[model samples]
Target: MLRDKIINAISEVGFDEYKEISSADIIFADAVFASCKANTCGNYGQNHSCPPLSGDMDTNKQRFLNYDHAIILNKIMFLGEYYEKMESSMTEVFELLDRLRDQLDDEPVMIAGPGGCNLCDECSAKTSEVCRFPDQKRYSMEGSGMDIVTMSRGLGMTYNAGDNKVGFFMMVLY
Candidate 1:
């Protein structure tokens, strides 16, 4: 089936855990979710893939709803004793996501990665400039108002793997 093909592609790209879910099964976007990013995450205006830069909450939600299906991809990695390796881990996960996207021949695929766009060492948004890698930049699922924890639970996926174990989530929508 097509879902199996997508899952195979994900595995080829090095993601071992994934689920194919109808877009209808996804939890609806909520503006309050976006507020969490701006209020606490501190990447609100720092990255093109984040809020205020990604798009308005309503627009992001509508864009997401336009897709009929999605593949939720995940990777489990050691987060170190105190999460010092977070940045490197996030970048690696997104690189795997990029490879997964390349394997999909389907048109109109949108990928919402685990964190803000880390395409560059420093975001151009910090310099008051537009994104330098618009084609490569990845928005976070949360940045688009997704409640990933709830979504994962709804999909029968484990959100928290364990202590010192970090799980990255990305969605390939088409």
Candidate 2:
């Protein structure tokens, strides 16, 4: 019943594609964690949901394992000729993720999205202060060391839409 509820919420939120998988099936790789340390996205030590602040790889893996089921969600967007609409596309995905979060507000689920948590305009972690909204804090899929590309490919979900279109992913664990 909860799965059905989640599916319905996802439908209402209008994600492009989704698949249900056992939380245990989630792939965690140290290499992915290493990438976070590289700080390509620059949230490494600056966001509570990112590495160094989100905890070590083991902790994050355990957190996901605590859940039995996960629904992977995706939204595809058309980037410009040079993929210039990236920022706006990411914002749209986050907005959709927010809508899904709100739709499932009453459910006991953990959501992991594309990048660092956007629950706040500026994360308190930047000032070394305690997270302002610990209870509502969102987690990042890649930040949590999830090998999303591999997972997506294995599930036959579209990670690359081609033609300058790309897929942004997120997951709801319950």
Candidate 3:
């Protein structure tokens, strides 16, 4: 029932694509790319919500497993290159995430995304401070400890890695 409910909510999103996972098969996008890592993100320790600050994957998983179902929401960004695509695609991802968050008025949910979190222009990850927008910001999958390529395979989703790759996310709700 929870799974069906989440699927219904996702359908209302009109996203490029959305699916309900029996159990989350999440993977961080950077894990699929050899050159990427949490520290690799300039905002890594600089943002309260990103790595070097946010909790690790084991903790993240404990939280996620509490949920009965998860919904994977994705968009295909056809940007020109790596740097440019990260900017545009991530922006779109946050926008979509914001919309999704707005739609879930009473549902308690957690989302894990692609690369660095730009939820705020300047994150407190640098100052070793608390997050200003605990309700709005989320940690990227790789920023934690998920090996996305492996997770993708578990989900039966083939990750296509390239100079112009498509970024994605997974939101788990209890």
Top of the candidates by lDDT? 2
Q: Could you estimate the TM-score for every candidate? A: 0.83, 0.96, 0.74
lDDT over C-alpha atoms for residue 98 of model 3? 70
Across residues 1-174, which tens digit of lDDT does each residue of candidate 1 receive? 766667677777887578888876767566545565555767787877777777887777787789899888778877888999887887687778778767874655788886677768899988989888777777778777777777888777767789888568889887
C-alpha lDDT of residue 114 in model 1: 68
Candidates ranked by TM-score:
2, 1, 3
User: Highest TM-score: which candidate?
Assistant: 2
Q: Determine the C-alpha RMSD for candidate 3 after optimal superposition of all C-alphas.
A: 3.8
Per-residue lDDT over 1-174 for candidate 3, one digit per residue giving the tens place of the 0 to 100 score:
555655666667655555566545544343423334335657556765555465655665565677666666666666665456666666776777677666665666666666666677777666666777877777666665557656555665536645566536555455
Which candidate model has the greater lDDT, 1 or 3?
1
Query: In order, what is each prediction's RMSD in angstroms?
Result: 2.5, 1.0, 3.8
Model 2: CA > 4 A from native: none
Worst 10 residues of 1 by lDDT: 30-39
Which residue pairs in candidate 2 have backbone atoms (N, alpha carbon, C) closer than 3 angstroms, thus clashing?
A: none
lDDT of 2 by residue, 141-163 (tens): 99899999999999999988999
Off by over 4 Å in 1: 1-4, 28-40, 105-107, 133-136
Model 2's alpha-carbon lDDT is 0.92
How does each model score on lDDT? 0.76, 0.92, 0.60
